[model samples]
Target: MPHTIRVLVAKPGLDGHDRGAKIIARALRDAGMEVIYTGLQQTPSMIVEAAIQEDVDVIGLSILSGAHLTLLPHVTRLLAQERAEDILVIAGGIIPPADAQLLKEQHGIAEVFTPGSPMSEIVRYIEEHVRSAKDLELPATA
Candidate 1:
């Protein structure tokens, strides 16, 4: 059987709000990808650990707490340290455009979606990029 696309939706760094994360999780699930939603207030280490343990294809981070620069990069760095950098990393929230670009350019984040981003676009991006990432896989990690 074909491997199912697995995604981990995470809230990092004291982000008490979770409606967006939950919605994305549901949407990924509805898209036929297995989604693991790590509830609110997760540390970067916790998020990376869960992604590793769950063996997800993608890590979707939702942060409304304005700590994306720190928390998001931390997760990617941890994943690299763990030899799991193949996992596609994406972010969403109230992130400013410049920070989003920095996250993708400097950090290892694959994409950053803002508040008004349509769910379909997010889903499509994951579907396309995860497949492409897998195609070039070094074999471990997401």
Candidate 2:
């Protein structure tokens, strides 16, 4: 059986702008992926905890409040520490290309969708990355 792609859409820190997050959630659901929408004003810890509980394969963060530099890294660090490095982390909202590059280089962010990115594009990215992640597997330690 094909694994259902589970994703957590989170709004980190004081960012209350969730319209984009909700829309993306709907789109992902339409694409047959299970999505957990964490609503607005989430802390990095809360997002990580929810992702862990949900056992999601991807975490999509929407931070338009210019806190991406701080919040994105924090989430990445937590995921890495938890041995959940396989989870694909992507972000959207108000991110510059330079910062996006920094995110990918420093934090292993799979992709960053900027404003006006089509829904289909985002959906395709999730599908592709999820497949890629599934292809590379390592056995757990004793």
Candidate 3:
């Protein structure tokens, strides 16, 4: 059996919309990946906590309220602080080119997708980018 990639789909900050996040969650699930969706208005801390607790390999953040700069970076920073920076972080929705580049270059975001980006592309990216959970060396449990 193939290993399923575990992904946490989140909408951080005051983004009151969730259609895109839902679509992505469905896409990831359809691709045979385990997906957890954190509904609207989640804080960065909430997102990171869920990611760690769930032991997901990736975090997909969908932001539409124009707070990508603050929210995305804050998420990465929190993950770093929690020693969870190994989790791959990606973002989607309404991010500008410059800001997206900055988020990728400086904020530890793995990728950013905008409107009109195909769901297949999103699926393919996650499929290609996320390492299978089995590939990771887990600490020995007592």
Compared with the true structure, what per-residue lDDT tens digits does model 3 show for residues 1-142?
4456899999998888999899889987877778999898999999999999999989999999999999999999999999998899999999999999999998999999998999888887776676452364332212
Compose the digit string of candidate 2's lDDT tens values, residues 27-131: 988888889999999998899999999999999999899989999999999998888888899999999999999999988888999999999899888888888
Each model's RMSD to truth, in Å?
4.3, 5.7, 5.3
**Residue-wise C-alpha lDDT for candidate 1, range 1-142, written one tens digit per residue:** 4567889999999879999899889988877789999899999899999999999899999999988988999999999999999899999999999999999999999999998889889877987787776763322223
- Span of ten consecutive residues with least summed lDDT in model 2: 133-142
RMSD of 1: 4.3
Greater lDDT among 2 and 3 belongs to 2
TM-score of 2: 0.93
Scored against the true structure, residue 78 in model 2 reaches a CA lDDT of 94
**Model 3 TM-score (2 dp):** 0.91
Weakest lDDT window of 10 consecutive positions for candidate 1: 133-142
The backbone clash count of each candidate, in order, is: 0, 0, 0
